[model samples]
Target: MKSGGNLEAVLNAGEFAITGELGPPRGTSIEAVREKAAHLKGMVDAVNITDNQTAVVRMASWATSLIVIEEGLEPNYQMVCRDRNRLAMQADILGASALGIRNILCLSGDHQQFGDHPRSKGVFDIDSIQLVNMVKNMRDEGKFLGGDDIDGPPKLFIGAAANPFGEPFEWRVHRLAKKLAAGADFVQTQCIYNMKKFRQWIDEANDMGLTEKIHILAGVTPFKSIGMARYMKNNVPGMDVPEDMIKRLKGAGKGKVATEGIKIACEQIEEFKEMKGVAGVHLMAIEWEHRVPQIVEQAKMLPRPVITPGSGEA
Candidate 1:
């Protein structure tokens, strides 16, 4: 049952697990994959390999995940409904398992309008929630989507995305519950820039006892520059960036802005450590992977835990 790599190992051991994101290279060369994964090797419990993120074409998450494993890193393979139907999705579960992939993150994906291939046809054959349920069924019931028996089902740790800052805020927690109900083992929330709103959302989850049933890692990303902050605030849908945060980043000296960003990220990680219902922090530095070691070390999240067989088993 531990096929999802150390992600399940770390989570089951009840440690504050750290997860990172790695977008696959646009080309086929595996060297690009190794270079990006090198930054996160020991710093994170797992690395989420995005599936054609932002609708832009990239190396397949499944392929990249195998590369991560080759580099001795755990991959949380992301799957989007944009390109695959339920049939393809189910096939991937088996294929990925054969390739030694374990953890999987289900996503509805960014609309095609946002990617380079705007004219690409969208495949809404099944939404993310349904995908979660399907994968759960495959794992638990050992059956294919059409009820055919599987030879050997994939043993995966399921994950879903949540956005605390999205509008109709109070209901966001309920949405998270829906993912859990659909059989999500864990959840990684969207980047949380609005701490106040995230606290509110978390309070709702805690009140409902959802956090106790499933692991929830709050997403944290640092703003590298004034322009980045502005883009997230003004352009990113479902993101809420406060004026104070923008001001702090803008106030920093030109040469020190990146350091300031790291400082801010560390502060959020520190707060996440003490927050109720938060299992850990999901660090998404974007292309800023090099800063991950510094941020986690400064946040005192280094010296990652080691899980033995008896320690992490269900």
Candidate 2:
């Protein structure tokens, strides 16, 4: 019953969990956040509030997470190591817990150079794996990183990011194992466009028995247009968009690419449902929140299952 959150309960109950992402607005637009969350309210088990994603500044993740909760959705609060020291990290964890944020995704955020602020100094005091261990200790030991006692430790279901498409392919599984050892209860991988490679990676995890130790939620994103597909294929690091997929998008003809993209995403979700090591799908409909329900329904993941607390059954 880790964290007693819907995500953990769904995974524990052996349901194919669905999670969505919500990027905070660049300014103080609470309405904007709520509007985006409204699109995903009942379509996903939990929503991940990205923390200064791509190193661009925005509303703080913890605050946005609270807003999502106010909208009647559980938040998977994301924390990146690029902007905060350990002290700030632990403080934010405590604050998020106090605010009822039960799920968190730990990450080594995109480097600052890639963002609007190229000159900003990064404070990568600790890597993502270390951050995972820190959170686990706080939850299980009720102690701070400095070994100090806490009046109340955060009971969070910790998560970390995985890049199964990263090069030196053999090391990907080992990296996941390291995160599991560091106490990541679950992981959401980089966007998976290369299903062949993803299947191989999951098979490796299954062979190592890593799947049983950690919940691996395969990441999926629909290509909104041909430009998006080409950009991800050539520009995005660790993204593997097969050429045939791009051709397929082109084959869809003008004015219909977006629809084709959604169809492809639905097909991917169907495949994920049958994948052995996959516990769920993390639908990262970047800025396309309004389309989430359509995709989920088309994938036949509609009417999400309900898991009663402490029962571990959907």
Candidate 3:
């Protein structure tokens, strides 16, 4: 019942929640946000609004979240530590809550070197785990990081990211445990291409009893082309796109690669539904928001569950 957000309600009700991602436009265009939100409305339990994802500047996540709310959809507001110190971070947290934002995703954003402003200095005042703990304290303890009491605390469903494909595989589950201990209410993993490795990671998480403590939403992203597949495999850190998958995209021939990618994503989502410790799926359609309804329909996850007010708590 924490936050009473749609995402929290769905998970608390034992429904297989489906969340989508919406990257804000590079400029201030309310129509752009609305258009993307239109594609996601009702197709997902919530939509994640990214915060200058991949180090590229864009419309602020909180502002985009409010636009999404106006479009009749819930937003999972994202905050990255790469650009803000504790002062700005806490200020935004309070503002986001006052704006009715219910879910917040804490992240250590991609390094500035990867973005348009390569020379920008990062303000990594605190890491993602610490961000999670700070948010939790603000919500539950009604106090700031420096121990000052807040008149009104943010009521948010806290979330953190995980990469099952991250190297030194043995350490993945432990990292998740750290976030859980930091009071993360839910987790969304990196896009899963290697099912075997992902299953192993989740199995270890289950073994440690972490699943009982937090909700894990398996991440899924559809490849638009073989080039995209290869880029993710060869370039994106912590992204494990197996060669066979790239081959599958290539096998789709010239005009059909996107279709095949959606098929692959749908298949992976089906498997996640059956996997233990997976509470739901986080569909990162990545500018392909128009295809989300089709993917949900094809995966038979349509007609997302309706959670009544006050039904989230027992």
Q: How well does each candidate superpose onto the true structure, as a TM-score?
A: 0.98, 0.99, 0.99
lDDT for each residue of candidate 3 in 55-79, tens digit (9 for 90 to 100)? 9999999999999999999999999
lDDT of 2 by residue, 1-314 (tens): 76989999999999999999999999999999999999998999999999999888999999999999999999999999999999999999999999899999999999999998999999999999999999999999999999999899899999999999899999999999999999999999999999999999999999999999899999999999999999999999888999999999999998999999999999999999999999999999999999999999999998998887788943
Error of 3 at 69 (Å): 0.4
Q: Which stretches of candidate 3 lie over 4 Å from their true place?
A: none
Give the per-residue lDDT of model 1 (tens digit) for 1-314. Answer: 44647888888878998999999998998998999889988999999999999999999999999989999889999999999898999999899988888899999999999999999999989999999999999999999889999998889999999999887887788889999999999999999888998998999999999999889999999888888989999999999999999889878978878889889989999999898899988999999888888888998998888787676876
Q: What TM-score does structure 2 among the candidates reach?
A: 0.99
Residue 113 Cα positional deviation in candidate 2, in Å, after optimal superposition: 0.7
Provide the overall lDDT of each model, using Cα atoms, as 2-decimal numbers: 0.90, 0.95, 0.95
RMSD of 3: 0.8
Model 3, residue 65: distance off in Å is 0.6
**Better candidate by TM-score, 1 or 2:** 2
> Candidate 3: how many backbone clashes?
0
